[model samples]
Target: MAIHSPSLVELHAFLAVARVGSFRGAAEALHVTQAAVSRAVQRLEEQLGVDVFERSGAGVRLTPQGTALRRRTEKHVAALEAAALALRRPTERLRLRISVAPSFGTLWLLPRLPDFHAHHPEVALEFRQYHHEENFQREDVDLWIALKAQAHQRWPRQVAAEYLVGREIVAVCAPQRARGVASADQLLAQPLLYHSNYPDNWALWAEAAGSALPAQWRGTGFDLVLNLVEAARAGMGFAVVQRCMVEDDVAAGRLAMPVAACASTGRGYYLCRRRSLGAHPAVERFVDWLRLQCAGDRGA
Candidate 1:
């Protein structure tokens, strides 16, 4: 069955007249002449197939149907007004949704997010984290910040990618645990920490340091870099971790890079998206802002 819907203008007028109880009073509130208010209510009545109000010498009264319709229409009209206000607002005024790898987000992105917030006060950022790459097709996020090596080919592909961080992984551990990794011989002799995702890290680091550590020298596996680094900080074996991720600990003297024995890791961070949103003002501003912040790391 077909249903008739009242126009916004007429609905608003009906609501105002219903509240004010008289055409003259409603006209005063709406900043229109009483005749206009009368005409608007007349149109609203015609649209709804009923006489909504009865005009008397002193005031106006609502019919039984008009009373019920007013109750329902009041809520709907308020909601519509709010939606219209949102549509008229600026894009930068809205919040942005961003997704990223859990390890990188916890150790790196979150720490620097305050700077992004301060720089772009208009764009409120919303963060989401995942343990591994997933299909962005199912999500409605604006951007993704992925962590991988410079040569790491298995990364999210549906989004346009931009380099977000460098590929420099430093050997990090507590100040005391930093002793055994001083030389190739000592490194080969000591227990080495390993991230489950990067099983060849020990091999890669050993070759980069020109050491011949046996593949058997690798130790217990932790799936997350943060967990591996945490274990390293607590006197567990040493692991090659991103410099930026552990820079705070190194500065605080909790973790130190006694030896810079690492590879170019061919993997780095990449900012991704489902498709080119075509230089939307909000997107362009965000990308530009991110580029400026990551430029310092790129320069290094």
Candidate 2:
């Protein structure tokens, strides 16, 4: 005999009755009348040419064939329920996931994120702090902020990068620490803090200030620029940092430039993204806002 497909309504009713062991219970669960549940089950039984349920003093019990069919139908019903639930849910919003250096994320990007949200409320932004180079194969990251040198040298062919802003290195210390320091040599004589990654920052700044470093110059080293800034503010030592990073601290009197000289490293921050997403609207808005921020920094 040829097999026939059973209607979803009949299959649903049969599974409900098999689970509850009665048409009345199934009707209550399905929010339908008992007669409707009975007819649906009966239709399924007739199509299959087998008795699916047998009435007893206890109510009703599924036959062996019914039990086997119920097991298969349960999976189908669950899948259908899941599909219906998914369809009923609200549509997901677009998210722009970004990866950036920890220092930049904390000191620069985070402060300006609220402005982006205020202007573009519909787009969601997510930031991940990363210290290493970008991996294009990672699907989670839509964009990255990296050092200009690293961006130029290491960016993959699948990605593109644009220069954001070059940094002006300045020597900073707590107000008390700067009170007596009149010259670069005097500032260098005191305890100096340095970023571990940029060991030559102080040397470069000294060159720009037309001052010579004392032989065997050394200082405390921190892996992150943020930590170095904090140490300087706490009077742990004088720190040579990017001007942009400490602009607010200087204005707030938490830190002071020991010397008025600033040096340009020729290195800068770069905004990078996958080439495929170069024209994406969300990416464009963020990049435009970032450029405006950078331009404002230059004007400052």
Candidate 3:
């Protein structure tokens, strides 16, 4: 039968004494008194029913048993320290990680953040410009807001979701780019930026405008609406983008309608997350506020 089973605190004391080889030294290392160190070591030895150290001529040496015990105790001691270190951190914070389309982050969310922050100062909002259909689990995210269809397809069925906006998608460009956009063919003659995921956007808008786009309307590619909008704003090309997401920029006289017609893309933004994450007060509050904001919007 074993002499004793050691408790973690006793092992801590044992490891300290065995490492330093002196009660006083162990006491200093442990930030404890010499008497406490002696008691701890005495308890360890008594529990084990073996001499762990040899004392002679102003120094100490470890017994064979002590050496073996040291090995075992060291591993446990390191594990204990690591576990303590992990627990020492604050695991919870009033923060939200929201991944969104690049254009929406810049043209919409960026402008409205101050309003959210003003209401909930404790909540820190972190907005990331992930692609609309990009998976969010790769990053440490608490919540995500993306075009609704993409969110539904990527996340599990258990996430509680709500639509945030039904935006009007229309072709927009700089005034110079919009100048000769009379017929679909003329409009199509100009370079058109195509979103990789939505290849048919330009075609759909052209159909809405009652003309087939010129064969070369598909001139360049853009991954996100913001890049397309930036290109259009700079007069490089024209691309279709969501109106609500670009309203502020449109109002600022930076972009103009490249075509008179707008198409209902049957898409909207959705607030999404695992149902469990909804329990967090900050997340819940943000969702509620977001829903209220959406309800007040005329487009929704």
* Cα lDDT computed for each candidate against the true fold: 0.73, 0.80, 0.71
Clashes of each: 9, 0, 0
User: Which run of 10 residues does model 3 get worst, by summed lDDT?
Assistant: 149-158
lDDT of 1 at 216: 56
Which structure among the candidates has the greatest lDDT?
A: 2
Score residue 167 of candidate 3 by CA lDDT: 51
Residue pairs in clash, model 1? 148-268, 149-266, 149-267, 149-268, 150-266, 150-267, 151-266, 151-267, 159-273
Q: Which ten residues in a row have the lowest lDDT in candidate 1?
A: 275-284
Model 3 C-alpha lDDT per residue in residues 185-246, reported as the tens digit of each score: 67677777777777777777888888776674446778877787788888887777776766
Q: Tell me the lDDT of model 3 at 89.
A: 30
TM-score of candidate 3 against the unseen true structure: 0.59
Which scores greater on lDDT, model 1 or model 3? 1
